[model samples]
Target: MKIEILLDIKNRLGEGPLWDAESERLYWIDSLGCVAYRCTHDGREIRAWDLPDAIGSMAIRKDGNGAVVALRRGFHFLDFRTGDVDLIVDPEPDKPNNRLNDGKVDRRGRFIAGSMDTSEEGKNSGLYRLDPDLTLHKLDDGIIVSNGPCWSPDSKTFYFTDSWSGEIWAYDYDLETGNVSNRRTFTRLDTSTGGAADGSTVDAEGFVWNAQVYDGKLIRYAPDGTVDRVINMPVKKITSVMFGGPNLDVLYVTSMAIRHLPRFPHDPVERGALFAVRDLGVRGVPESRFGA
Candidate 1:
């Protein structure tokens, strides 16, 4: 249960902490800064690429050339060597107000992501699946700020959150076809308790860990959607969570620091920094790569 700051880079909107096991490196993004970052597990050899638009999330490619990113414009191929971004498609071309947000690669190597309504009021966004063939399919619609896309250890259930709704939904996942069905409410946060849902990851033991943004709580849930444990963080704007490190035992967290909090002026200076939670007594499954 030891919490320590790994990097105090002061990211404006830090999200998407991804662990690359093949290279033993970490990847993340500063959404507001329009920058993607990479570093070692110990936070060294840091490199960054300036993207044209705000990036919500990214998945490493099997070929190791770069990543398939969910940028504000749409899905694009980000080349690590040349920094060239090639657009795939804009799933929400008609809804100019919505942008791609949280996403993850399923066990079958399909990139699943959802859009978010920038206004935070409309339910015009959609959940989409990008197949290995570079084809995108719409899975669900009417979401307002999609976040925390992940699945159960057995690949039978898919979990996703619409931050504005304060509830995380579970769907029947078909690994063979990459389709989702039978949507049901898995858990609902009494925002008074843990704040809204952000990013999430499933551990090796079939537990779900989620970061609650405003309240700064990292919640671990059993497979039945019951709260198993809760860890309070030092910062309020904890944006995302992942399991990294060589052993996949270290829990990495990202946070947001968009502006000075006039209300909580005494907030810790590490609010926007990256954090590592070690000695959790648990390990995590490796994240699947896109097109792998």
Candidate 2:
């Protein structure tokens, strides 16, 4: 288990690391920077496109040239070639203060993303599902700050995080119909340790790995929601994680650069860098593509 900087490029609000297995490339977003980026497995041949607005997250399209992205305004299609953005839908037309946040593609090809209150203190957002048919459905609501949307290896259990509540919730998932129910607390972060759950990913063995923001910890949880291990990150504002590289054995991490936040300082030159944890002795399932 060795961790090293993959890219030293500082991202202001880096989040949503995704692996495109087919292309052997890595994609990620600098949320506040309003940019989408892609690079080779070894961090070479990088390319980027300026987005229309702050991008929350994105999924590789089934056809593979572009992506389906959740921007601040709503869901949109991003053409990596021409830098074009086409609107998909804005589920929350009434909640002007909320923005789409962390998201991922389900095993069944539906994109599940949650919104967060920009104020960071209002439960005015909801979780949504976007099917391949281009229809949107609301799954759950009353969320303040949503993060960490991922499912178990079997795709029967869905895990999500409301950072403000400090709790990671699990729910029953129907892969066939894209329905979720029976929500319950899976694990709660001890914020007294100075962190909240940021982003998460499930391994091929069914363990959940979460990036703890402000506390600089990467926590691995067993299927039963017990802490299996913890790795202290070099930066305090670790935002997201994903398993990339050709074999999906590398854990790629994203972090934040803004220093004057609530509790973070202006130190740690690597605060906004991208990282790769190698030789973890674990592999990850291929991320499903949108509309696949």
Candidate 3:
């Protein structure tokens, strides 16, 4: 399969790659640069928005108007038509040292997001859930850097990663109560080698795909936590991965130059651009909408 750059916008720290199947477009955020982009899958018809604050991730709304985004301070509803940001509750009003990070919509349409400690020295951040009715819930605590959060095919299990701990954990998820418990380790990585789990997604076949940032590795883990496949990325900071394209066979991988190998074919230009792996031979389930 040929890997190609999908966009040359070059983000400072490109994370959150999401495909809005309804519009046939891809949405992503440059976490450190305070910007977000909407583009054609082929890198054409691009539109960039300069956000007032840095955004970690966003969840597409069921109506397709815009998204519910996680910002430096809190979550807000970004209206594409008027460029307005409607305030949502800030779960951590007193914790100024924490910043929002990776997030995704749940099967029930609640926006589940997590925060990270700015200094990376304190475990002050945790996972949060933003209900469609505008209520907020703290799902977990004692986390330094929260990354991946995707559900099992049956919606009975949830997988989350603490990037700093280099471990991915699983929880028995309850849809009716929006609760997760029975936390246990699903997989672990050696951050001692400077690699940790980042953003992740699930395929229709029930496999979990995660990008190991700062280590240039993509691992496909079986439901029981066995390594199924390993993909060597061109850049070290492979922040996130998601399945897109018409048939959902294209794997859109986001990268950053925050860390890198000694030399690669595309050095500086690969700094924070999005890349695509075509005909990956797998398809992903459609993303759940924010207020579905």
- For this target, which candidate reaches the highest lDDT against the unseen true structure? 2
User: What do the candidate models score in CA lDDT, each in turn?
Assistant: 0.90, 0.91, 0.86
lDDT tens per residue, model 2, 138-229? 99999998899999999999999988898899999999899999999998788897789999999999999999988889999998889999
Write one digit per residue (lDDT tens) for candidate 1, span 24-133. 99999998788999999999999998999988899999898899999987999999999999999888878888889999999888999999887778999999999999
> Taking the tens digit of each residue's C-alpha lDDT, what string does model 3 give over 27-73?
99888888888888888888777788888899998899888989989
TM-score for candidate 3, residues paired by index:
0.95
TM-scores, all models, native as reference = 0.96, 0.98, 0.95
lDDT for 94 (candidate 2): 84
Question: Which portions of model 3 show Cα errors greater than 4 Å?
Answer: 259-268
Q: Please identify which of the two predictions, 2 or 3, would achieve the higher lDDT against the true structure.
A: 2
